[model samples]
Target: MPVKVRGGLYNPYDGHIDPYSVTQALAAGARHYGAVLRPHTEVTGLRLREDGRWTVTLGHGAQLTARRLVNAAGGN
Candidate 1:
């Protein structure tokens, strides 16, 4: 047996992926784990209460309390 080629590259960890689909799947998984998804909502401010909880202020002066917060602010 003989092989002939000008140039080539092989990698076992190389592949193509659709970013939008991946993002959607991740969001779905988060939702399954009881994650609230609020799109187009802007976080105005954050305050720590005396009880060690976080008071997150959103746009239009709306506020919500949470034990933990995740800032996944994507690019513009």
Candidate 2:
């Protein structure tokens, strides 16, 4: 089991996650729950709609309506 890690030493951790495996697992789980995963898609613009929905613009003039958005881009 992995424990909560708080910074103390130069490098202190009890566990690590395989990025590739975790990503694949998350994608699979999302798909299993009927969520569409669009790879290679870039967000170009964002707009708030009057109906409380979000208008997300993607690369190459694609757009989508999302009820929620999460900023999961870590250090990128």
Instruction: Give me candidate 2's TM-score against the actual structure.
Output: 0.60
Query: Per-residue lDDT for 1-76 in model 2, tens only?
Result: 2455432223257456676787799789978977776666788999999999999898899899987776444434
List clash counts for every candidate, in order: 0, 0
Residue clash pairs of candidate 2: none
Clash pairs (backbone) in predicted model 1: none
Off by over 4 Å in 2: 1-16, 71-76
- Per-residue C-alpha lDDT of model 1 across residues 1-76, encoded as one tens digit per residue: 2355543345578676676887899899989988898888999999999998999999889999987787878644
> How accurate locally is residue 56 in candidate 1, as Cα lDDT from 0 to 100?
93
Evaluate residue 56 in candidate 2 and report its C-alpha lDDT on the 0 to 100 scale.
88
**Would you list the C-alpha lDDT of every candidate in the order shown?**
0.82, 0.74
| Superposed Cα deviation of residue 41, candidate 1 (Å) | 0.2
Highest TM-score: which candidate? 1
- Give the per-residue Cα lDDT of candidate 1 at 23: 80
